[model samples]
Target: MTTLPIYQLDAFTSHLFAGNPAAVVPLEQWLPDETMQLIALENNLSETAFFVPVENGDADFHIRWFTPTVEVPLCGHATLASAFTIFNQLGFAGDEIRLQSKSGILTARRDGEAIVLNFPVQPIVPGTASDAILAALSQEKPQEVFKVVSRDTDYVLVYESDKTVRDMKPDMSALGALADRGVIVTAPSDSDDCDMVSRYFLPALGINEDPVTGYMHCVVAPYWAGKTGKASLIGYQASARGGFIECTVEGERVHLKGRAVLYMKGEIYLP
Candidate 1:
């Protein structure tokens, strides 16, 4: 049997079950795409990150993220979790861990006890709301809708209040029928601790609701920053397994800071 080491980690939070769980697998070389997809299905986490060492280059590794149903272009919490594995478990010597991905070269470095990820900002633009989206979300009329034009299109629904975002009960089956990667719901935070609150839903990608989504914040940070006139702000994901993110928008980049904790370690035996 071919055995590979695997780690499950709770990302974006210091506690065990409060954040999104991702599986990390380090490989010496690339595996077949089908094989990786199978592994992701077996892992059945929000995301499974696979990485291989880069040969004498600017990046430390080349990484990819997979949901149970599909491969995604970018992911934030999994990227952070991958850096944690490299720094703490794999004994990476450098303070900065760079990853080459489909989106582009992504960087992560330490910020006190937290890890900050430097990701390209995904700008949002005005968009029309589809009836499918409205039927799927089944919430109060969104104040506005925006489009994230990335590898795949994701809809952003801006609500009037954080409570509206938190109280959402999306129709997963209806959401899965929409022709988009997912939907991001956000609103101004009523709390003093953060500027905005959000929840992510990607039923088509096999996640009904994602806890502590970092990729979604890459878009939310700048949108809220522009509205609030602050370069740095805090965000809270109001999932049952809640998580916090410290967001800073710089020029065209977004920095997301959060903590992670390892949940389990095991070996995957495949032939």
Candidate 2:
């Protein structure tokens, strides 16, 4: 039997039971895709990240993310959790780590007590949200809907208030039947501490609600920056287990900063 180190981390929050939990596994070599998918299914978190060190490259590791049901092109919280596991548990000495992923090279750096992830900004366009989508998300109408086309994430719903976003009870069956991955609902924050509030639902991805999603915020921060005329903003994901995200919109990259706490650590005995 081969043993691999596994870590579970709560990303985007300083405390446990607040942020999005992700399983991080460090491997000397990659397991089969089926095995990784099975592991993600067994973990049953929002996401699971696996990484293997690269011998020669600017990137320190090759990382991949998986949901219980499928592989995702990019995942921000899991990447942050993977970096946390590398720096804190795997004894990585560097202050900066770059990962090669399907989405391209992602960089994570230590910033005081938090990890800052540099991710590609997802561009949005005016979306064609159908009446069915409007009905599935909420009884009240949305202010607007924008599409993040490249990521398979269909619509970004702009609700009028944070309360509206928080009070939504989406039809998961209806949402899953849509032609895209999922929808993100956001609104201007009610609190002064945060500029915006959001909730993510990806029923097709087997995640009905993501607690705190840094990846979704990559699409949100830039759009809000254009609307609010602010380059830096703090967002709160108001899921059952709430969490915060610090966002800065650069030219083509979005900087996502958040804290991660170690939730569980163990050795996985693989057959």
On a 0 to 100 scale, what is the lDDT of residue 155 in model 1?
Answer: 87
Please list all clashing residue pairs in model 2, or write none if there are none. none
lDDT tens digits by residue: candidate 2, 188-238: 998899999999998887888999998899999998999999999999998
lDDT of each model, Cα atoms only? 0.91, 0.92
Candidate 2 lDDT (Cα, whole model)? 0.92
Model 2 lDDT-worst window of ten: 146-155
How good is model 1 by TM-score?
0.97
In model 1, the Cα lDDT at residue 115 comes to 97
- How would you encode candidate 1's per-residue C-alpha lDDT over 1-271 as one tens digit per residue? 8999999999999989888999999999999999999999999999999999999987889999999989988999999999999999999988999999998999999888899999999988889778878877865789999999783478898999898888888888888878467889999999999999999888878888999888999989999999999999999999999999999999999999999999999999998
| Candidate 1 residue-wise lDDT at 59 | 89
In angstroms, the error of model 1 at 180 is: 3.0
